[model samples]
Target: MGRGARETVLGTLGKATILQIPPELQDLTRRFGEAVWKRDTEDPQRKLVLLKYLDGNYTNYMQERTRFHKSSFSLEILNTSRQERQLYEFIVSKGPEEKVWQIQLEVYEPVSDPSIQILGWALVNDSCTITLNCTAERGDNVSYSWGSWDTSTSGLCSHNGSLLYLSYPLQNTSIACACTASNPISSRVVTFNSSECSYEQRGKFPRTEHLVLLVVVPIVAVIIITGVFTAAHLAMPIAKQEHLPLAEDSAVHTIYSQVQRVESPDKEPTTVYASVMMPTA
Candidate 1:
């Protein structure tokens, strides 16, 4: 057959010419015949030779001029797609004894590169919740895994599936987080730095609130204290001046009352009695 025709047939069979036959098709080799044969190269136009076992010798059935007669033949096909059945037919007894063989093949592709995304704003200080997402572009029978490497301590943490929750007090240095996409055929991984992630404030109070506490509160207190001290200082001189005259007036009134009492004693002589004591040498 032409190269195009062979490729068309192989494509219809859903098989690649370069790869090995899948394990599900291994039974077909025994069912067809003991000897299994397949193409070793990627050339689509390569001849497909079938060997027939008869009369204690193997004969090439594709050769029209061969002297050996054909009874049973075996052929092996490789690199078939999964969950598909293909049919093969050949003439055995020339007229009505033609038989057909059916085989099922299963093939899987390698896992594609895993994609990693931060679910929300990630922070190192444990102020906010952080999550990670992992996905694969294409694969068959695939699974996901997550891991992180502590750059400071060379420690490793592993988890399964597409989602991972991160906790606080992360490593001091940058952390390498990875997502791996795996399948029976192959696996792929992707990595990113935790330090590159963005962080957001989740608390009701923000850094600005802290700044207000640190700066504005002390300033307001100082202003209030200064105003109180200024008001007290401004009132002290007024209070002293208003009370000084009252004290002097009370002293003068006491002396005047004593002199008047001695002068007017209801006509009785209010005399001042004095006793003189002599000092003897």
Candidate 2:
């Protein structure tokens, strides 16, 4: 039989090739065969050899270690897009299985790098606030610890979900922040200095001044205007010379009385006629 045809038959039977053929397949079935000869040999759990041909410069152990670290195997097909179930069924229907067995191959792709971010930072009024942020590959959990440069204090304050914020009063002096994030396969450290200080004013000037001026300016203006009006009303005016016009009758009486008091005795009484003169051109 042709190689491809033979492979197809073997694969259908679940044996596949000479490398995976059991010793019992070598024995021929006969009616006269003794019990010992016919005894079924336990198929040593079929060992799938993952052959890796490294370059000339690479060592055997290194290749093995790399394969182990990456968790790669011919049977262990990586579901890159995680569409393994669909791909498995499609490949099974294509051509002969023996042709597929002739190809012994696998590819190793490097894993993604780790991601680190500063999610948030907290500042305590009297103490120090320590924080940490790190994310690993999906399905991987990160282990971490916190420590300061000062030997006086160290411990796991608390771990809330993905955030780590702590206020330590004991080690309030000049200090540094350091932490190690790790998984089963890898680990890394992140640190920062306490000397980096920053400042901000949180209160609002517009709202505060708006409220104060709203209450004070009107009150002061009203008091000033009231005091000015009050002083003007209370002030006493000093007296000065003011003339009054006399009435015609009163003027005549005053003249007669003056004449009666006259001291001329030897003179005869004389009649006097008063004439009013008109003003003319």
Pick the TM-score winner: 1
> After superposition, which runs of candidate 2 have C-alpha atoms over 4 Å from their true positions?
1-125, 128-131, 136-139, 156-162, 168-173, 196-281
Q: What is the C-alpha RMSD of each candidate to the true structure, in Å?
A: 22.9, 22.1
Tens-digit lDDT track of model 2 for 1-281:
22322121111111111122122321211111211100012344433233321221212232321222111112223232211111110011112231112222212222234344544444456454545564545323455655555565445433423455655553344555565555544456555444432333112222345668978999999999999998776663322224444444453322221223334788766555454543332
Tell me how many clashing residue pairs each candidate has.
0, 0
Q: What range of 10 consecutive residues in model 1 has the weakest lDDT sum? A: 1-10
For residue 41, model 1's alpha carbon misses the true position, in angstroms, by 27
**Candidate 1 lDDT tens digits, 50-134:** 4554334566653432232222233433335542222222222223332223222235666778887766543435433457788
Residue 72 error for model 2, in Å?
21
Question: Residue 269's C-alpha lDDT in candidate 1?
Answer: 57
In candidate 1, the residue pairs with backbone N, CA or C atoms under 3 Å apart (3 or more residues apart, or in different chains) clash, namely: none
**TM-scores for every predicted model:** 0.39, 0.28
lDDT of 1: 0.50
